[model samples]
Target: MWVTSSTDKVLTPSAIALGNFDGIHRGHQKVLQPILQASAVIGCPASARKVIRDSQCPYATVVTFNPHPQEFFTGQSKQLLTPLPEKVKLLEQLGVEQLVLLPFDRELAALSPQQFVEEILMRQLQATRISVGEDFRFGHKRAGTAEDLRAIAAKFGVEVVITSLQTCQGNESEQPTLRISSSAIRQALAEGDIDRANRMLGRAYTLMGTVVKGQQLGKTIGFPTANLQLPPTKLLPRYGVYCVKVFLEGEGENIITQSSIKGVMNIGCRPTVAGNTPTVEVHLLDWAGNLYGKTLTASLEKFLRPEQKFPSIDALKAQIAFDCDLARKILERST
Candidate 1:
């Protein structure tokens, strides 16, 4: 998708979906569908025949905030379900033609409801139609509501579509209904419920980062690992060993495909080895190569065990061997 700032001039009108869309979870899909449906009727560029017949068709744009408004206002560091680049990829896969990542600062946050609709939506984006979740609010401490959006947008000849919140049945009998949201997915991941988080996300929970050098303790014990330095704001599953698939970052024509290798990943401080900080270390099964200075995307499949402090290095090594064998079997079954 063509990405631009909210202040950029729009040459063509757009049918836009607006939200934080941090995780782009199933509920976000409901908010986005109206824009896609409108795009199809308006003739997006991808369908050449339709575009040829309707030259004035509006582009499908997703307008999202960066750093999340909560993080911006509170200045608190928190893990996000999906980072900006990953969110962009997800939106593109959903057939969005353009993305407008608006910077959330004090100035933008100070705009009144009417000013936001007139200045950003109508004047800048040229939005012919706008879609948002029923709970969506904006402008000056969220003074604007979905009802406010409709009234203000109409003055600019813009159409407003509000999507109802989506929910899924709870897995446990105690809780019957659960709203699908980014916070819910984060809670699942923080609790190490990978399956539930994946179900909510519509995909596996993934971590992407550049490989960095570590203490080389894994190599000394016969299982060499590539340590990953992840973004500080990226949310992590509970500290544990997990079944994962690894994809090496590629250059030009040598792009590596996802799930090209199966492995066991440890996400924690190596307590048994007297390590102090949490780290992501992965050992590729039956594979060896130089991975320093390369990026890798690790997709978590299942949680195996929590990080522990073994009595001895030999005992830790033996436990790792068992973890590897278990991970191999799990990966095999998943395939």
Candidate 2:
């Protein structure tokens, strides 16, 4: 996607979509369809035909925020569905033509919904049309609902579309009718239900960071690992050993260098090793390469067990070997 800093830089007529778009889940997809369809009608070509017409050459843009506006208002707190970079990558994959990242500070947060619509959406983006979820609200106090948007949109010669909530089958086959939200996904991750979390995220939950040097205890145990210094700000799953897939970031055309690997990861302080700090360490099955200064992206696949200290180093080694074998079997079976 072509990312634009400000609305002023948007050179083409635009059909805009609004959302935090945390995970870009199915619910977000429901809202996105109309905007994409409108774009297509306006000569904003589909996936392959990325060209545009002169008058109807509509630019598709998504307006999102940084520092999550909720951090300031809501009592709830947790990791984001996708960080800014990851979010941008996902939007690009979804065929977004432009991305407008708004800095959510005290000043921006205080804008009344009408002012935001007039200044940012109508004037800045020059939105010929706009789409969003039915429940979506904007402006300082979230006083702007679909009705409010429609009322104002008419005055500015803009068209507004409100998408209905998309429902998916939930427990006991009940229809869970709500948009996938970062808050719900965070709760699932906290509970160690990676599968449910993935359902909401529209993909596996991942942690990406630089591989920093750690105490060489894993090497001594014959199971060297790439230690990731996870950001304190990022959401982390329940601390435990899990089956994971590790890959070197920016290695190739592949989003994940390797589709996945049968591997074991420890997500906690090494209690077995005296005085070790909390860390994320992954040992890729049947692979060995220098990774001290490299960056790695590890996606947790399944939670095997919680972090535990074995009686002896031999016992720990034995457990690790078993874990590797189990992971291998699981991977093969899944494939």
Best-performing candidate as measured by TM-score: 1
Query: Number of the top candidate by lDDT?
Result: 1
Provide backbone clash counts, one per model. 0, 0
| Model 1 C-alpha lDDT per residue in residues 123-195, reported as the tens digit of each score | 8888888999989999998999998999999987778999888877677732676778888888888888887
Model 2 lDDT tens row, 107-150:
88889988898888877777888888888888887878987888
Candidates in order have lDDT scores of: 0.84, 0.76
Candidate 2, residue 159: lDDT: 86
